[model samples]
Target: MVKAGRVLALLLLLLSFGVTAPTATADAAPVLSSVWTGTWETAPSGTAPALPGAAIRNVVHTSVGGTAVRIRLSNRFGTVPLTLGAVTVALRRAGGGPAAVAGSMRVATFSGAESVNLPPGWDVLTDPVSLAVPAAADLLVTVFTPADSGPATYHRTALQTSYVAAQGEQRAADEDGTAYSAKIHYWYYVTGVDVRGTAAGSVVAFGDSLTDGNGSTTDANHRWPDRLAERLQGRRLGVLNAGLAGNRLLRDGVGPSALARLDADALSRAGVRALIVLEGINDIKGSPEASDPVAFVEAYREIVTRAHALGIRVVGATLTPYGGYSAFTAAREAVRQKVNALIRTGGVFDAVVDLDAVVRDPASPERIRPDYDPGDHLHFNDAGMRVLADAVEPAVVG
Candidate 1:
């Protein structure tokens, strides 16, 4: 190497002649950008009774592995300021439930503090915690509050089971989880879990109960989105499900309308590369029905336009068959057929995943395949979810 004094003298000579030196780091390691992908998420569908001094153990499955992770808590439906006494994240034991894997727990802080206070209708993300998160694994995010902060923002239809601690208890940091005995299907406070150093972005599965795994086996993680995540094992793309059971595209009930909450649930999510939409069946079947197929098609186009504006590719999924359901009417079927045709041919999305074509019975055309139907006729079984996942071509996704 050249001496330091000689290098300085050379630089000064070059500067005197108005010559600039070349970058010395041309062969150095490339600088990497900060990449944080949303590995798992659930939209807030409604509010539930607050737990007060209790802790909620929200069990969430990851779509991608990472060297570090962060948690998001929500008070979107709260009328009062929500105060969290403590928060912790841990890997779950193999058998599952409240118990955590030994030495895998990490405390979550807000601005380096153990506690955080969230105002009404707002959400907050915890500071990053160094942890090794495995892909396609379970994580237990425990939240404890010492005071009654009014109605809690919650996702009402998590098909997987979560746990709730006894009242007057603050066991957010508990690893054994004996304090959490009461099993609950609701996910409280915790809205999302994000993993870093995995994929640079994620694909959002956006829709209603079909995407939410409404008819699949409980605690099986067999939702279509979950199955899709399994296929993305090393594709460098995370998968996040933004489904709401009974959610509609034109109206609000189980959650805000798909259009109204699009940004909150899917568009604004961390590092979204593509979106898969499987909504509109509810609008066709619900009371005060949206009879106009034009309305539904317009909504799909709007979603595509909005996603495209942010450089995100949109995938449209045709609504599945519901022939044997109680709300199936010939007129509603006609409306569904019209809307689906438009989605398939109207150029509403960058690509299409024809879920209805795969899950519908070839014999009846309007009914779900016998093996895939879980007796409800509208929703899919584990096998059907697998088919849906298989139908999503990796090449087509952004």
Candidate 2:
């Protein structure tokens, strides 16, 4: 009996240690990962035509919570090596002005040359330093380049807002020479901005130009995802914009196709909790022969399934109104409506963001409200972009 009692005590001791030991390490909160958000606009450093429409700028009001950040620059569609003369990141005060010099500025550069060679399709350039950011703080990331090739392959679809100025100007410089003094909706090659938090987990926004904020104002970080990030300020969610201009759901085009880019864009990110997918417009518009409603639905399902397998929640965003676009036709409109129906009623997604319902005109369900359309009848202006952000449901993120 004595021996048996000792054995029982030993077994109990082992069980208690096993149960408590593992949890001690497991109980530590996750290390939150940050996402970089910005746009790829045009410039004239070489024989390349000057990109005049909307130059990128630094946005001070839009950034909220973050302790550390990393900025990504792209050489992704350059024929020649792009030269960045100097790059600086600084803090901004309220009303879109520069803040008092409370923190030191950081410099960003590539390894090989003062200029970085960006091959045909993609380039990921990181800052030379990491920044210590604070909650509800605003900072500006500025890049200076001596020249660029013609028609710099800009990221037309930038979900996060950014600011830009001429080659040798500061964010707080006088408006006469600043490229961003006059707001326009164009971006240059800086693709993303990542913020670090004390916790673990992040979210990636994956889609095309609309998700990229094609028609929104430049230097004004007013993209919907930007607003979403602002709303999620204190929550343990990090937002990354993986949107690409002319990106498709299944086919490869401007940036990488959705499926092809998935690993690099979302899965490979440091810590990902959920993926918000707002794609398929380009696929529907570009591929007339490829328009099998069933196939489109299946592809979407596959994307969600793959994400789920990786333990990531998949959030589906209904494609916004595009009935007035030059490419819009009765057939395409039918497809759009059909796909949206599936997304809304389809249980495949873990959650849904009905962008269509939010921006569509009540009188004309097929088109966007004039107030919301950024003149292209497809994209949103700054105000319209704000509505898009408001349309997102916070619960869907979880």
What tens-digit string does per-residue lDDT give for candidate 2 at 172-225? 332322345444333455544555555345667787777666787765656666
User: Model 1 lDDT vs. the true structure?
Assistant: 0.85
lDDT of each: 0.85, 0.60
Candidate 1 per-residue C-alpha lDDT over 4-27 given as tens digits, one digit per residue, 9 for 90 to 100:
999889656533422221111111
Query: Which prediction has the highest lDDT against the true structure?
Result: 1
Where is model 1 more than 4 Å wrong at Cα?
Answer: 1-34, 167-170
Cα-based TM-score, every candidate? 0.90, 0.69
> Which pairs, if any, clash in model 1?
none
User: What is the Cα-based lDDT of residue 285 in candidate 1?
Assistant: 96
